[model samples]
Target chain A: MFKGKKIIVFGDRDGVPGPAIAACMKAAGAEVVLTVTECFV
Target chain B: MYDPVIKACSHVLIHTPSFVRYGSKPSREIDDSTTPVLPAIETHLRSFEEAVEYPPNQVFIGNLHPDRLNGIEQPWYRHPVEDASRYGAYGEIMPEEEFLGLMKLADDFDLMWIEKESAPMIKKSLQAHPFWNNSDLGKIDAAVEMARIHDKIENQGSLPLYCHGRIVGCMHRHHEKDDALKAQVLMENLMAKASGALALTHLLKKSDIRADEIDLLLNCSEEAVGDRYNRGGGGLAKAIGEMCGCVSATGCDIKAFCVGPIYALVHAAGLVKSGLFNKVVVVGGGSMAKLGMKFKGHLAKGMPILEDVLGGLAFLVTGDDGESPSIRMDSIGKHDIGSGSSQQNIMESLVLKPLDRMGKKITDVDRYAVELQNPEVTVPAGSGNVPLTNYRMIGALAVLRREMNREGIDRFVLEHGMPGFSPTQGHIPAAVPFLGHAIDAIKRGEMNNAMFVARGSLFLGRMTQLSDGLSFLIEKNPGRKAPN
Candidate 1:
């Protein structure tokens, strides 16, 4: 799944991809797009 | 705001039967109310010594197998075999026939079983899902098809029947005999204990390093600290320090999941650059609770079990000396929140930005080692993608460098990257692939610089999650003077 999709957005709730998921998505060509960290008010 | 440097590094070590010698008994816990299970930390440390063939003087930094819990064989999550019983309640115990069938299928198709328990879960889930209810034959047929495809891709070998079978059987029992939520909790707890202990013990064994010498520690694993019911705490850092006799050790957890080790390395490098700490250890423990997950999925797909190993890994990073392969601490790339970028933008920020800052092209580097795991492990999970995420990252980097485009990137990765090599352990996919080879390549003076990258997902908490990462370059003998 890491090919030709010029634009990809990877977002999770707490803003981390556990090593396995990150590696897999990167390998699949997602570029690790964006990481949105939660801010506690 | 941190730069990481690698002064001296150690060879990557692996351990098997890590907690076997601990025996099937619970150790005392700091809290009398909640007893923690002891993981095979000592056994694995001993095995790690053998795997890397390190001399006794090498200082090791890692975690300790918590001495807690009654080594009772909890029906849903007990080791099926006696020898595998020491690592906690979930080292070995899978269904033999089902596991064998999955291995045979993996061998026939070249697939790597990622998680040993995946097969069984798939089977149960599929059986209960509406999709499978429509046509039972279709579901089994789909599983078989997936298994065959996985085998072809991962280059399967003979199955480790006994260990894997026991694991599978235990998992099956967990689901069949216990409540689903309770089973999940128990499984998670066991996995956390095993991963924590393995990584911690392995860290302590490093003679070339010491806990007091390390200013930071990073624990990367698929199992996170928090669950649906509670916030998280009690990671490997503190536990490891206590085990290693370094009571003052301070550290945090880094999650990019499989890519966690790389992230930990980068984080350590950054800390060193910031002058916050002189030494740091990036470590991960094996997930015994996750054993047989892949096999369970395969069984669902009419295949045998494919998982064969259980272990953890650790790396040490120190202030860079101009002479050693230093991790270029300043050359860090990040996908800023405002970078209105697509996937390519994300790739560019995370991969290209750092290279651009360093004025280096992808081809300029000697050999690119990205996610290096055996595909045979993950394919049967219906994850058709090749397991080497790093190779793909390298290929993506090449594309951004104008060497190739999207299609070309795919072709290049397929051509250059190592295929399906790592067991389907969660953190195995991270930069662990390069640890062994990178050290050798640097020692042999074959490569001047290598990149380590790790990424993780934080969405499992049901919050709006995004991927975060860290990257740095390891160079050969930069020749800088040692720190005073």
Candidate 2:
């Protein structure tokens, strides 16, 4: 569904990390521009 | 100097394979069913010798430092050390019988009772340890008859204590019917106190500091020690302190689930930094709830249950002595309530923001200690490798910030991350286990800084959906003069 799409991944340290999400994006034929992992208390 | 430094640390383990059947997960399996027993679970338990030789357990107790783990083969269970000792440089892997004696020594009320036959052996073992004194040895009582123990187990709904498949003692209930004060819960609390005291005693010996020198003690274990009226009312800190002759140390408990140690470390550091206390010790005992948490997987995979040991650790935080590393209080990071719960968000606050403020990058940290649950125990349970996942996440964050090329992400992990060696105990694996190795590496000038990151699953409490996390840096001491 993300084919030909450009994505910016925002991840959590405990949940899905940015790289894992970015990998998923790549797997889905999406271009990843940037990723950031923010801490949530 | 008012800086908070980790003067010394000690890590201990209790080989409580018998107690594994009583863990929350297994216990529930008994209570919720009619069988009241776990079929063939006891057969899979490893003996003390096996526990001592286990590579990860050796790392936990400092017989083998964490850095040495790289040389050891994967599936460490298959590669046991030759002629390993229970006594380690940092602490000891106590036998179940000795730990029970300790539980008796720690008990103030008549909650725990031991069989008379096992008392003498226990006394001899306890006296052989360098940490205890005659006064401490006087506390263990082994005169209780087996009939009383059997009665407690069969009639009073007490929990049976075991060693080598035999009933060695029983823990009695506090109230006739209070579920919160039942023998099982009380036993869990007492185990925490005893294991914690053992670690503290080792800390006193390792640090070469008097127990009375401590001004405050913080209990950061997973057990809740209290009566039914106040179910979670806690004083394990003082209870454990008293057990180890910390007569002058006052204490209380701190709870944030698995992130509790980091939270306690920060609070202890803050207390020392504020000059309110000169010495603060943070301790975490093993969790009964976590033992045998993944036994089904281990049994299915035809491997010995690795979650059979109880872990305990202690750290002494005091003013910088111009030698030991100091905790970088200036770079503390916390997951604010509004930070939002996402992998990206938690990492941003814990790993990025703190380093960002100090003009540092992800690669700057010599090492990162996060959820370090051993892969052997976790992977078979399908939990994946927790520490490896955290390192990858951090590497990903580095890539996101352009601090490193995406192609070098795996290399970053290899350089900065370590293999997980801690047990699957709830709080034990949450980043604090690396403190001992980190301290040594910094003193040896092998590394300059290590960051400890801890994240808690607050949602498990059903209190809120909010997640919790805390991070802090420990770096080589930058000398500062003490006030005259």
Candidate 3:
């Protein structure tokens, strides 16, 4: 739905849904840049 | 004005039996009500699933489950997923068979069923998906059996799990059923995870967005996730992201009881507006604790069990485009720690103060979406109508503010408030559901501004007596492009 929209995403490694937010942004075709403070995995 | 606009929102529902017995409140509600209806209405979820609307914007999931009233399908009946009019912006009500497949995908989250038993069952049970490879599952079965067999025998309690009328596997209680870290809790948590993943998947699918494009994810549900040492809520966002192909995503969990979604929305909006992030998504998985929550009430009412659904929502807030409704940052409402707990106090802070700050009246908002639990589901349970109660409070606030006369309160409510259409899934009925409708209405010139109000009971956690609330306005696009 967000076609051609310039969407920059930010996520936290600490939160449960942060990576979901980041990955969804990318999947939505947003130009994403993920910043992981710490990797939980 | 705010930089972040609601790019899209998708709602998804799934019917699973996990909530029927394991959900504490629902199980208790069933036991407490004299006329408990067990197994009689298990098929009702499938029937009701046919009626709920998909995306353009829909409100009520409607409590009329035909199968409960007449044990078979009527010639006129059509499932929501099949019908074009019934489905909402988010997605259609996924059938039970598909949802069972998802539970398998989410199994690694401390959930395990007997492989020799469930494996063959799942082969026939699970719907087709990329993750449903029997070969891949064989590896998990081999590894899990060696470890799980040690816990399956004498001391552990094994509860056989069922799905779509077939035995899936025995859910061995590694500890007591009440043990928060073991069987029951683990099942509930994993169901929520799978449900959330399904929603996120649909949201991405409906929005035509790519999973890898997601930058930030926030899980607003209050699910606890951890090992034996530290049982807590964490990393669900990333796990869901990974499940949906969001390889580059990072995430966090936001906990505020029912108000968590609103908090996540505000935080996401701020990040987008502040140029810290552009595409921000907020998602809340369905609550296992809430499923079958009012089954007994529905049974007494001779209606279908309406609480069998798992509610999941995913929405993207991004820098504004000329077409989408944008979030108004300046008028955001918050109930501070010192804010006294009272109906008037909450209404004042959430409704009037924000409007006052925005230099608008109570009547300025075209509609208010708050705690919109369907009366059909709640009234039978003696919970009364939650959305109606909320509307009355707002109408009473309007009367107090002299926005309208007390005598016209009903009329005001009729005009400004909507009938409760959401399932009683706590946070699912909160403000977020309205975003889909408000966006549609605004685009159609039906309304210039709409407010999304959410309130959470902090007292539920026993940590505080204060009630939490969050409110924000979504206005017409203003027909302007965002500046670089």
Candidate 4:
């Protein structure tokens, strides 16, 4: 699915799969776009 | 949107032998004598009780059949598995031996201990009670039959087992009972279940976390609570939080029918990603109305009884530390109607698009575990594609990769995804089944990533709403270095 798409993950502060997803997506040929952590105010 | 990065993950499975086994038909047939009983319920219960480490003091019975369940058409047909077993050839009551074999299979898949003693209490209390007397002593008869099955297993040198979670609460609905009395009993049951879960939370506090550390509480169940005016988020959540000593907690319900656990995981992941909660407790109580709905089918086919047991489950979803991969909440996908209405579109919106956005391909995942319910329970409806929703989603991922097309999606799914291996219970298919296996794979360095997808049918109400949700697991490659 990640042929040429740019990947991004919007996550809760404690959400999982942050680094692993990024690395896997990168390996699958998608450019790692950004990993933003959604902080609760 | 943020770039997805996974730190660590852990999946744990609590096995119980308390699964129920009864003949399909109410009448005993010659073939029924040949069916072997599997002592799944007994073995699991015994394991829980004998465990040297964590003995469950609280148990949550998720779905049980009160001698009678109210407000349903042909209460016997209420449980799909029971219907399939009685009317269709596909539904087979898991004989005691087969039931134990399934539990053993779970062990092969990495489930820990099974819970034991609870079933005896259930068998003793309700089976022979006047409330369940209508089935011609069917309820108690089934319980006694299952106990006999357990005896056979014990004679074979199998260890008695129980699941790890304590019996905190229970919910029972008798169609014939007074509404007020039923409500009172249900409330007490809920409180007990919540208290049991809370006690576990306290135990957790003494282990690696503290009471104050828990940030979110999730109550997962099929029961839709609230007055006709306001129905959602049952009292179990707040009550559980209060009983467990969690100071800041609000309960929310995740209803995906049986896939509530996966949805709960995804929701918990979102809360964690949003910095809203550090520690989230996801809990589910049991439903008794779901029991023994398939006896006729089972009896006709000479298969074991289909509805044998009802129980609840709970888990602690937290931030991944250095030792485990985090939930990777940022990569989740939702099924909005805008994603398209066809099966293809639904799959794309729920699975493909999210992964594409994450820049991951289908082949990169070691295994795709979605809708892992055992087919014996769901196949009688001629719904051959019961788990096909998940398979189709995975196929869409393959199609997105240009490796397959509409016609090939089915084959692609068969090749990539695991079989439907969960029980017919509501939350069994929820990502819980894959949690332990996924974590173990990552730890063993055998796989680098896996996908956990769960879907729901919000349309069952015919409100024009679509039921859908998706979550994937990206395991850490041991060969890769940490990004500093």
**What DockQ do the predictions score, one after another?**
0.07, 0.13, 0.01, 0.02
lDDT by residue (B159-185, candidate 1, tens digit) is 221231133222111223333223233
Q: Model 4, range B183-210, lDDT digits (tens) per residue?
A: 3234323322432342334235334666
* Per-residue alpha-carbon lDDT of candidate 2 for residues B188-228, written as tens digits (9 for 90 to 100): 89889989988998899888799888989999999888877
Q: Which regions of candidate 3 fall more than 4 Å away from where they truly are?
A: A1-41, B28-87, B114-155, B172-178
- Alpha-carbon runs more than 4 Å astray in model 4: A1-41, B1-207, B210-212, B227-233, B241-250, B256-259, B293-296, B380-385, B404-415, B477-484
Interface RMSD score of candidate 1:
11.9
List model 3 lDDT by residue over B1-484, tens digit each.
3457888887777766544665666566456767654555564443433434321113432222211212223222222324444344556565555565566667763455644555554554443443344424442243234245445633576544666565545455554534656766776677778878877876786675688788989888758876566677387888788778787678888888788889999999998888877677788888887777776676666665667677888888888778888898886998876555445665788888989998999988888888767666777776676666678888888899888899988887778887665777778888677677677778889889889888876655656445578999999888775566
The lDDT values for all models are: 0.45, 0.85, 0.67, 0.45
- Give the higher-DockQ candidate: 2 or 4: 2
Q: Which candidate do you rate higher for TM-score, 3 or 4?
A: 3
Candidate 1 runs further than 4 Å off: A1-41, B1-207, B226-230, B256-259, B300-304, B321-323, B339-341, B387-397, B404-416
Best by DockQ: 2
Decide which is better by DockQ, 1 or 2. Answer: 2
Better of 1 and 4 by TM-score: 1
TM-score, per-candidate, Cα-based = 0.56, 0.91, 0.78, 0.55
Highest lDDT model number: 2
Candidate 4 chain B lDDT trough over 10 residues, lowest sum: B51-60
Worst 10 residues of 1 chain B by lDDT: B56-65
Q: What is model 1's C-alpha RMSD? A: 18.6
Candidate 1 Cα lDDT to native = 0.45
